[model samples]
Target: MNYTAMLHTHTLAWFLMLILFIVTVILLKSGKAKGGKIVQMTLRLFYIFVLVTGATLLIWNFYWATGVKAILAVALIFTMEQLSTGIKKDTLQGSRPMVLWTQFIILVIIVIYFGYFVA
Candidate 1:
């Protein structure tokens, strides 16, 4: 919590991001992962929103995306976009749960790196 630092990745942004993730978690838990088109579209919208916000964060919070963390950060963002597209057409490369788990892990790491390293 350095008082002098200015940032857009503050509590509110992360909270909104968390809400996006949580909505996905709930959808999956509802067995909506295989739900009708509406559910799938809702989930996709959530993912797209998350991806967009992530890119916005990367742009505005460029200070965080440096060193090895920089590469990881970009890869994470790309993966989100890839995932969103994959799910859009239901042509993901592997197991659905696996992708969801991997996405969760990536988000966790990005959040950690952003909070501790970027600042």
Candidate 2:
């Protein structure tokens, strides 16, 4: 696929992933582990989509800033996965979830900046 198409796909995947992440967290918080797990599994598929598209874009256009953005994007994905798992397992002690959420948000901003403006 062309770069434009790939970029659009990547954007759409991340958008859907964000929505699914919110839903999964809400379900888990509401004591609906089964439903949350199902959504979480679906969310994982979107993660794969985002990673694949992003990787394709990077391969098509390699640059130092883009490389950094890719790394940050991966970190953002990892943070989301960890936060959801922590919520599901009830392992997030006080402030732990908050910290992860903060990291996730910051990484998102940085990644967006690099993806859009820098790169």
Candidate 3:
């Protein structure tokens, strides 16, 4: 796809992933096991979409800012997976959820900053 199209796709994927992440956390907090499971599965797809589109955009034209953003994006994804695993293993509890979610949101903010301002 062209850069313009890829950019649009990346934005859509980013927003969708953010929304799904919020929803997943909410569902888990509310003890909606079934809904959380479904949202988790769907969230995984959006994760792939964001990664793929971001990669395409970067490979099309590489820059230091985009490189940093890409690295942080991958970190964000890995952190999210770790959070999920923690939740499943019942290791993270109490204030841990808030801490992890805050980190995730901060990562999103930094990524967006780099994507829009630095690049």
TM-score against truth, every candidate: 0.45, 0.96, 0.89
**Model 3: per-residue Cα lDDT over 4-79, one tens digit each:** 9999999999889988877886787678888888998898999999999998998997988888889999999877
lDDT score for residue 67 of model 3: 88
**Pick by lDDT: which candidate is best?**
2
lDDT of each: 0.52, 0.94, 0.85
Candidates arranged by lDDT, highest first: 2, 3, 1
Q: Between 1 and 2, whose TM-score is larger?
A: 2
Better of 1 and 2 by lDDT: 2
> How many clashes (backbone N, Cα, C below 3 Å) per candidate?
0, 0, 0
The local distance difference test score of model 3 is: 0.85
lDDT of 1 by residue, 10-96 (tens): 444445544554554455445565543355455456545545555554565566343345456445545544554455455666587
Local error of candidate 3 at 90, Å?
A: 2.4
Task: List model 2 lDDT by residue over 1-119, tens digit each.
Answer: 78899999999998999999999999999999899999999999999999999999999999999899999999999999999999999899999988999999899899988988998
